[model samples]
Target: MRIGELSRQTGTSTRSLRYYEQRGLITAHRDHNGYRRYDHDVIHVVKNLRRLLGAGLSIDDIHQFGTCVRALDLDATPCASALEVYEQRLRTLDTKIDTLNHLRANLAEHTKDLRQRLRAK
Candidate 1:
């Protein structure tokens, strides 16, 4: 199918598809008329890409493990690299959560102090 059809089917913007192509996250072939053509399975790939992005995976991270995911979907083959990537992302998320919790605690303390001062006034 053509780029427009892919975008419509995937509910993704044409610009984002182009960006994905440029970023090498997705591949397309150019027809003789210079139109971008994609395989039908690209819809699944795009959906997976969007899901990964929504999960906070960067384009670089996706590039690292995307082929593994595609193989798993298309051939029922599993790749160990995907596990490594997931583990790394989990660790990163855990660290971020710890930092955010600390910040929230500090913010709560400051808010309590402000509330006490307001009560005194």
Candidate 2:
């Protein structure tokens, strides 16, 4: 299919698809007219890439992970440095969760206070 069709089917924008292609996350073929042609597997690859990006992984990390993904070997112990990177990501997620929970608690308290004030008024 063409880029437009892939974008429409995947609910993704053509620009993003193009970016993915530029980033080497996706590939496309050229027809006689030089229009880019994408394979059906591109859709699944794009979805997986989106998932990894959503997980807060950087493009470099995604590329590295993609290698492992293709190898189908998850058991190989990574280097100490890689483990440190994973640990840092874990810590960042923990901090983000804590911040979000604090924000939720504050919002709940403010809502309760506002309701009480309205009732008193």
Candidate 3:
């Protein structure tokens, strides 16, 4: 199908599709008129790409998926490399969450102190 059709079907913008092609995440053939031609299976690919992006995986991290990128929808587990990337990203997120929680606790303590002082005044 054409770029516009793919965008409509996938609910993704044509710009994103082109970016996917430019980023080596997906491919398209150019017709004689210079219009992009995508295969039917591109729908699945686009969905998988969106899923990965939603999962907080960067485009570079998605490249580590290898063939698993195409198999994201399969019932089978992803390849080990993809699993490794997922694990790493999880650790990173956990660390950030922990840091945020610590900051929030400090902020809350400061607010409580200010409120108590204000009440005394």
Number of the top-ranking candidate, with lDDT as the measure: 3
Q: Residues 1-121, candidate 1, lDDT per residue (tens digit)?
A: 9999999998899999999999987899999999999998788889888877888888888888857645526336666776777789999999999999999999999999999999999
Per-residue lDDT of 121 in model 3: 100
Give me the runs in candidate 2 sitting further than 4 Å from their true place. Answer: 67-88, 92-121
Minimal lDDT window, size 10, model 1:
68-77
Between prediction 1 and prediction 2, which has the larger TM-score?
1
Which lDDT tens digits does candidate 3 get at residues 18-68? 999999989999999999999998898898889889879999999888777
Please give the ranking of all candidate structures by TM-score, highest first, separated by commas.
Answer: 3, 1, 2
The lDDT values for all models are 0.85, 0.76, 0.90
Q: For model 1, give the RMSD to the true fold.
A: 2.2
Q: What's the TM-score of each model vs. the native?
A: 0.84, 0.59, 0.92
Worst 10 residues of 3 by lDDT: 70-79
Q: Is candidate 1 or candidate 2 better by lDDT?
A: 1
Model 1's number of clashes is 0
Q: Per-residue CA lDDT of candidate 2, range 23-102, in tens?
A: 88889999999999998877767776666577787777666555443222334534454455467788988999999999
